[model samples]
Target: MKTHALGRGAPQVTEFCLGTMTFGTQTDTADAHRQISMALEAGINFIDTAEAYPVNPISAETAGDTEAIIGEWNAANPGRRGEYVLATKVAGEGLGAIRDGAPISRATILEAVEASLRRLQTDHIDLYQLHWPNRGSYHFRQNWSFDPSGQSRADTMAHMEEVLVTIDELVTAGKIGHFGLSNESAWGTAQWLRMAEDKGLPRVVSIQNEYSLLARLFDTDLAELCVNEEVGLMAFSPLAAGLLTGKYQGGAVPDGSRMAINGNLGGRVSPRVWDAVDAYAGIAQAHGLDLTQMSLAWCKTRPFMGSILFGASSVTQLEHILNGLDLTLSDEVVAEIDAAHKAHPMPY
Candidate 1:
């Protein structure tokens, strides 16, 4: 496994970031612990979780269970917290279970940070992120007809200032180390950067967005913003929520899969997505490779990627995913993937 610099002054993180969204619900506590231990032993020093986790069927009851699971691991294995880079997010608007769908504000951010610290059992979070913009984001398959013209600029700016003030307070209080963003647009990210610079607030160190063979929406503006702004991209779902793994090929939806629980994968289910998967799967087989490894390894080689964020419900799945760290894609494989992208783009 290789390591990459987080920010100009931040610590170096492993190329692959272990995502723990399924830690409590899809995966049992024992299985989650095993996966975490395996990831660490495999040289993965970055772990990403959220305050509102276990999200296959996100509910109010199991909301913070994932963080608690990680907290338990950290507590059991004392003196190991400083060895790994911990990243988690504060839930944004639209999650009914959190703050009753209220938008993130100064007070809400304070409340969220305190709860996350309690759940994680950590004195400080390496990277604290806004799960989504309060002004509404085009992420989570909302770009089809998403509109933000209804949002008032005054309200949005006020919200950003309020949250930044609270974030500065948290940083001063030693509760959070750095700030980041997720599910944010280029303009929204720019606004945060501008405000942070003008007010001397904490600059965002990373942005976690959905990036994979099937989804490249971040390639245009976000990529440029990330490079020039030095905000690394913590790419989530680098396999398109298992679509690129060929597990759901030939219409065989496995039992106890993510699709079985959510059925639509946040509206990612579609016919074109299957077509794209088949094309990639054929290429992987031709190269004597597994699609999972090919997909994850390709993410590591991207210039804009800081860490590839992926999750597994079982120890076997974690091993299978971590194996990708050793498999590097050739120029021919990259060309084939690009050709396939030209043939089938944005399936979901």
Candidate 2:
């Protein structure tokens, strides 16, 4: 488990972050703890979760259950909180169970942070992220027809300012250490940086967007923005929701998989997506590497990647992923990936 500075002078965190979205759903508490223990033993000192976890079928009943599991682990393992860089997100708008589906305003941010802190059983969050922008996002297959022409820039900036002030308050109160953005656009990140600069609020240190060999949407503008601004990219779903793993190859949706619960893989399992996955799988096979490792290694090669967040329903799967932390792709392999990308670009 290689460690990198999250930002200049920021705490060093593992390059591979253990994702706990399945803690209360596909994974039981015992298995979740075992996985955490295994990851820590393997030298992975970063864990990422969310307020609305167990997300294959995110429901009101299971909301916050994942965080509660982590909280329990933290309580059970006293004095271990400082051992890892814990990151979690506060769901933005339209979570009917939380705050009656309200957008994250200053008041709502205060409430959300308090609720998250209680659920996480921790006083300070290493990285707290906005799950998504209040308006909307191009993530989750919404990029095809994403239109931002009609959005109110002034209103968006005002709302961001309000959230930043609340974040400043939270920082002062020792509720959160650093702030981050997720499912956000370059414009949104720019607004955050500008407001934080002018108002002397907290500047974002990371952006947790989906980035994988199959999902290269962040390779262009987000990559450049992160490189120039020093905001690290905490890439989620570097395997494209397991698509790049070749587990669902040939349309085989294995039983008890995320695809089994949500067959489309969150609108990711398209016909063209399989073609792309197979191509990459072939590349990995030719290199005598697991497709999962090849994909994760490709993500680490990116200029702005801070850490890659990967979740596993079982310890066996996690062990395989952990083995790839030191797996670096050669230029020949990268060229093969580029060729594959050009052949099957934007399959999802």
Candidate 3:
């Protein structure tokens, strides 16, 4: 697999970032470790997780279990600790299990970093991200009625300053290599970047937002912001939580599948989504492609792409996606995809 330059101050990582959100729940520790080893063998050098993971049914008890599993892998593979780029996020406010649903504070920054470091069993994190803003985000299918009229610029900037100062301190202390964002808008991302530059703080290197055949919200203002500012987009859910796989074509949820586990796949299921999936699946079959491979390959073709983030509960699924990493789409294939997007813009 080929590598891409991550942002201005970030490291070069593999095109595909192995996401481990299913660890300790849908996937056992042994299966997760095997997947990690397989991903490394296939040239993937990026692994992304969060403290509030294993989220098909996120609970207080299961929280941080994913990172613990990775920490075990790190403990066992001491020599290969630096082989890949390690990334994790500090869960923002409103998560009841962490910090009593409080916003990320100066103190919580240190607290979360220490816990993540302990769970990951690594001396440093290559990328540390704010999972979401304290001001609330329009992501996670919230765009339908997302409103920002209640936001106060002054308060938002104040929080950003506080976090930026803390992150700068962390960077200086070598606890984290870089800072990134998730579930953020273009304006929100620009605010962080601008504040970092004007205040001489650490730069925002990446934005791990949802981008896939079903979710192209990042293609508009976010794309321009990313390309101009040199912030690479670590696209999560490149398959739209398995919607792009065409497995749920006719409301037939396979046993033990994501939909079977969560029932709604985070509200990704709908008649229009199925229609969009059918269109894309037909296009893939027409081009002699598996929808999974086609979806992953198309993500790599985006101009503002940093790395495509995907999760797999089994090594079989990981291998299936890895099989498509090197597959390139033709001009016609891309054109049809764009046409489909225009027809079914936001199914969810």
- CA-lDDT, candidates in order: 0.88, 0.87, 0.91
Cα RMSD, model 1: 1.1
Off by over 4 Å in 3: none
Candidate 1 runs further than 4 Å off: none
Using TM-score as the yardstick, the better of models 1 and 3 is 3
Model 1, 40-120: lDDT tens digits are 999999999998898888888899999999999999889989889999988868677877777888877888888988989
What are the candidates' C-alpha RMSDs? 1.1, 1.3, 0.9
Two-way TM-score contest, 2 vs 3, winner: 3
TM-score of each: 0.98, 0.97, 0.98
TM-score, structure 1 vs. true: 0.98
TM-score of model number 2: 0.97
Which digits, one per residue and each the tens of the lDDT, describe model 2 over residues 1-348?
A: 678888644568988889999999899999999998889988989999988887777888898999999999999999999999999888867355665677888876787788889988999998889988988888878999999887898999899888888888888888898899899888788889889899988888999999888788898888888899988888899888888888888768888998999878888877788788889999999989889999988888888989899999988888888787789899999999999999999998
* Number of clashing pairs per prediction, in order: 0, 0, 0
Error of 1 at 227 (Å): 1.1
